[model samples]
Target: MSKSFNAYILESRDKPLIIMAELIRKALIVRFQDKRDKMKNYVGRICPNIQKKIEGLKELSNQCIPKWAFDNLFEVKCHGEKNIVNLVAYTCTCRKWDLTGIPCKHAISAIFFKHEVVKDYVSHWYTEDTYMRAYKYIIYPIYAG
Candidate 1:
């Protein structure tokens, strides 16, 4: 994807100065607009992958049983297996959350048990604020001499 994008940019730069500036400006504007629309649509929402994970978690929460452990920890049982969840550490015995930076169903059930916001447990990288911050810079058009 990046290779194709870089190639397009390189080709654009080789065009006549007036056309090059216009092409680059249009490309940047389209990209910026797309990102802005995405950010607007997902305001107060987590990343798309995490959203799907949360949906999976909602279903799992119904099937799993949660027992409180020490502070911020839980023991969840599903399908005859026990998985430990530590809310403070954002980890699960299955290690899915630790490996993927997204909460697993067991952890989600634990959070539901405690009546906490599941989105809070999600990583900041998945937050809308972080997405917007990544694209906050304006791409200015350079005047062709």
Candidate 2:
């Protein structure tokens, strides 16, 4: 006697954490490419000291995104609504916006409502100590014999 066989399949959904990581990855890649293009056309090539600052800007830019993302950002929607906009810097409720600091459509709209808050939301690496230290040192030139 012969028996017939049948197979069944199940679909899977990605977890929030996995989705957030992917978004971050995409944002980072685009940011890198844009920075590279800017560096190439940089006019500081003529000055050694200025060049160093430009080079430093390149290196610093890599680490200059933000810390709030790592820690996680939170938000609220309506006056009585629960925190719907739970877009922590790294994990946006919408997924794409949070992962990448590009700001989601919703965030962009919200920003218009609260521009000051949004401006503060943007992470600035130039304010960091490391970059400040790099700018503090004098760039004295030495003559070659």
Candidate 3:
């Protein structure tokens, strides 16, 4: 991302401008606004990739059998193996959730068992609010002298 930003800055510097810094700021604002607009109507807090993971969890939830294991933990039986899921910790014994910031099937099941919202369990980094905050600032172009 930094590389791309640097490249953009270099490209902008090559152009004739009364104030290079102001031009670069305006360009960045436009770029960020475009990206933010695309994500403005997102269905939920998580990104598309994490949303795909959640879809997979829905399918897996149907196949797995869940047993309550005290607190926010659950023991899920899938494909003849028992995997532990701790909803509070946002972890699965399978290690998928720990490795990736997204929650795994077992954890999703545990969340379902507790009647909780899956989006609530997702990492805050994937939230729509966070995405909006990333591009919250707007930069207006300065008048060319």
- By TM-score, who's the top model here? 1
Model 2 C-alpha lDDT per residue in residues 1-145, reported as the tens digit of each score: 0121111111112437766555554554554565455545554322334334444433433332222222233353432332324334423455544554444434433443333344344334322332344344443433447
Pairs with steric clashes in candidate 3: none
The regions of model 3 sitting more than 4 angstroms off are: 1-30, 138-145
With candidate 1 superimposed using the best TM-score fit, by how many Å does residue 98's alpha carbon deviate from the native? 1.2
Cα RMSD (Å) between model 2 and the true structure? Answer: 20.9
Which of the two candidates, 2 or 3, achieves a greater TM-score against the reference? Answer: 3
TM-score of each: 0.73, 0.28, 0.70
**What do the candidate models score in CA lDDT, each in turn?**
0.85, 0.39, 0.81
Provide the lowest-lDDT 10-residue window in model 3: 14-23
In candidate 1, which residue ranges exceed 4 Å CA deviation?
1-29
Estimate candidate 1's RMSD in Å: 4.2
User: Which candidate comes out best when scored by lDDT?
Assistant: 1
lDDT value for model 2: 0.39
